[model samples]
Target: MSNPLQLEVERLLALGRTPEALAAGEAMASDWARQGQPLRALALCRVLLQLEPAHTRTPQLLADLYARPDAPAKGAPPAAAATLPRVPLFSQLGREPFMALLGALELRTFKAGQNLITEGEPGRSMFALADGQVDVVRLLEGGERRTLASMGEGEFFGEIALVSESPRLASVVATRHTVALELIRTRLERIALRYPAVGETVRTFYRERLLANVLRSNPVFTTLPPEQRQALARCFELRLVDAGTVIIEQGQKGDGLYLLLQGQCTPVLRHPDGKQSAFSSLREGDVFGEISLLLGQPASATVRAETPCHLLRLGRDAFEQNLASQPRVRAALMRLGTERLLHISKLLSGRAALEGDLRV
Candidate 1:
């Protein structure tokens, strides 16, 4: 389906309403960024940059948006522990284990403007900043550079890549002469296997980070207090489903609510007569299956992954056990469900009207 915002921007641009289109695009981009969907925000920014290449503020805005801090990951705890410092990932370990981890780390330095990690390169290890600063920049299509963030003393980067054994999402460059301690995955794995406590600490930290990001991204969870959000986060189970997988079949009993952390899915309604129509798409930060879960009814539509999806699922039992005490969350979910139902009603009405017009 065509994006209403994009269509509006295009219409304005066709009418030579450059200023209006720019303003609209800027507002939409800011909204998307606030909703924690950076890629969508960046897409809007790209359009604005393309139309107004000379607009100085657009580039700066893109940079600022990119520079917004992500949920903190495992990092060095303190500089007083050892030469490498006490990182949270090793916080629970005894002195011997901690020292062992510290010994495994290799201290590295880079000159100003030197790249410590490049986008799309395999990440074999994670790094903890010991001194100086590093800038995280993502290269966009057509060779544009967007600065994602900056890191200083004790901050961690590349942990996600290391954990998932995936390519780096962005490049990390030394903004100045910098010192960092590199933790190779293999060494870390060995330490973790030998010390279950160390492994659990890292796992807990990563899970918390994932939960925090999902909570921040999703509008329904935004109203939840930090403590409550943390409580709810612990109740979720992470699942990775492959592309084209049907997650929730239409008319099936809904057992849980799902929060999409990464990738996209489409909610499609299938009629008994074998007709199917996708009404909307869900991307990162979007929640689904809540309607059925809350109402204790069958799912109204099928949800299929459009890409490999990373999801956090909160089953009804967990929701009742963990979230029932939070009246605010319950109220929020009810309100969201109402809004979603209304949206579906509108979509159906619009389709019916179009069908009627076509028949005439």
Candidate 2:
């Protein structure tokens, strides 16, 4: 006898339509459950769950399958021990400290399609996935929602906001019925005070994550070795500039490289005649002041914050002392500085030509 749902799933897989195949598999699993074939349904659900861990329906279906009378007995450890090692966020923590941290966490459940965190909202807690999956999405300029990444069991999010005290960067939505362990900032603070090891562990993880994010987002830093990137990232000092604040003045000697972590800045060129021309705008993840850093000269333009900005500044002394050994980073910075100088020269030449035409 032919099973229509199974055939449909197979057809979708053959056509390389994985999303559709997973959906078809879910339907087939449902059919098997309805027909009182618990073991078969459990097998199909497990396969679908593996394929799309974020699918909200699959986990619940699997749980239901497990609850069936025919399901085999399983010896699972106490919940905390069973789940703690699974979370990558805390996997590096010593077993004793992790167990203590695990004891401090509060488990929460969210239904399918529920938002665990929303972009731009203040967040004071971090979440570690215990079961099911979530989709991390960013709201784009055009009002479109883009899925940044899908997270499954053992993964985590919200730590950046918690550590930096910044608003959430992206929205996290449950793809299915999900379970997560929430570690609130206040509770974590208390834990850190009681156990210094816990605090150190958290800080280490935070620094590593921040470095990885910065290096991953910027193409210029991607070629450098991971250890070098970590070293460079650690040397940065976070500075906040309010709107209308001048971060760098034209003709002032550059002291460091400023990487914009948040908000915007406009670079303005002031001519000898004192006429100021706004030449370029920089936003998050953009870097500036590299030209002066490379040349040991005064800043070429003034950069003013258009909005309140958060920046990671790597001072000259730190760069020379820590990052000087990394040839790839040095070469990349030199190339970047050369390109910017050429661009500025062209712009100046064009303006000169325009002024000459005006006088004629």
lDDT of 2 by residue, 1-360 (tens): 224433443454465537777877878777765554433444454456446655646445433333322222254222323221123444455544544554456646677899999899987898876566799999999899999899976566787655556778789999976766678888888877877877766766665566568777787788877777777777887677788999988899988888887778998877677776665578767778888877888988888999877777889999778656668877877776776666566566654322221100
Per-residue lDDT over 92-162 for candidate 1, one digit per residue giving the tens place of the 0 to 100 score: 45544554565466646677899999988977888877556899999989999999778886677777644
Worst 10 residues of 2 by lDDT: 351-360
The lDDT of each candidate is 0.67, 0.67
Which pairs, if any, clash in model 2? Answer: 56-175, 56-176
After superposing candidate 1 on the true structure, give the runs of residues whose Cα lies further than 4 Å from its correct spot.
1-86, 139-144, 325-327, 346-360
TM-score per candidate, chains pooled: 0.65, 0.64
lDDT at residue 4 of model 2 (Cα atoms): 43
